[model samples]
Target: MDRKGWVMRAVEALRLATFKEIQRYLDEEGEPFSKKELLDTLKALVAEGLLEEKEGVYRPARKKGSAEAFRRLFGD
Candidate 1:
């Protein structure tokens, strides 16, 4: 998987994670990502409604119909 995929996987596995936690998970998996890269990816994910953030903590947004909406809108 790519870095973004890994990021999503890490967040999904953790359910809720801080920036450092996501970074650590990626590093432990032998895929060290730059801080800017991770943050940028997270920002995009949040914008796409694939993820959510609160007080710098991040989590996958598990809302019904959201995935379908995203696929329709973004053609994922």
Candidate 2:
């Protein structure tokens, strides 16, 4: 997977993470990424609405359709 993909995977796995936490997760996953590159990717993800950030912490964005999908798969 690409850097952005790896970053997204890290955030999804972590549920919520700070920059340093993401960096460490990537390192442990054997994917060494520069701070600038990671930051840029994260900003792009936030802009694209694929991830959300607050107070320097990042998490996967909860899309409007996700709740509908969940209800379909389970129940109201």
Candidate 3:
């Protein structure tokens, strides 16, 4: 998939997004979006390697390293 798709997937998987949850996030954000845009974005993210599937569940792949440093330094 393209880079935009990859980025979206990374965000989704990192966030462990379900389809409906992702849709709801977009919806409740109070911005306007067409359903097609949301779904297509998700499908593209799935095409990228940012998400992993386990037992029918999808979550963002864990980045290797320490969040401890990040947390101490930047407070996320």
TM-scores, all models, native as reference = 0.82, 0.84, 0.47
Between candidates 1 and 3, the lDDT winner = 1
lDDT string for model 2 (11-61, tens) is 999999999999999999999899999999999999988999999999999
Give the clashing pairs for model 3. 13-60, 14-60
At residue 34, give the lDDT of candidate 2: 96
Angstrom error at residue 34, model 2 = 0.4
lDDT of each: 0.92, 0.95, 0.57
Model 3 — TM-score against the truth?
A: 0.47
- The TM-score, computed over Cα atoms with residue i paired to residue i, of candidate 2 is 0.84
Clashes of each: 0, 0, 2
RMSD of 3: 8.2
Query: Candidate 1: which pairs clash?
Result: none
Cα lDDT for residue 15, candidate 2: 95
Query: Against the true structure, whose lDDT is highest?
Result: 2
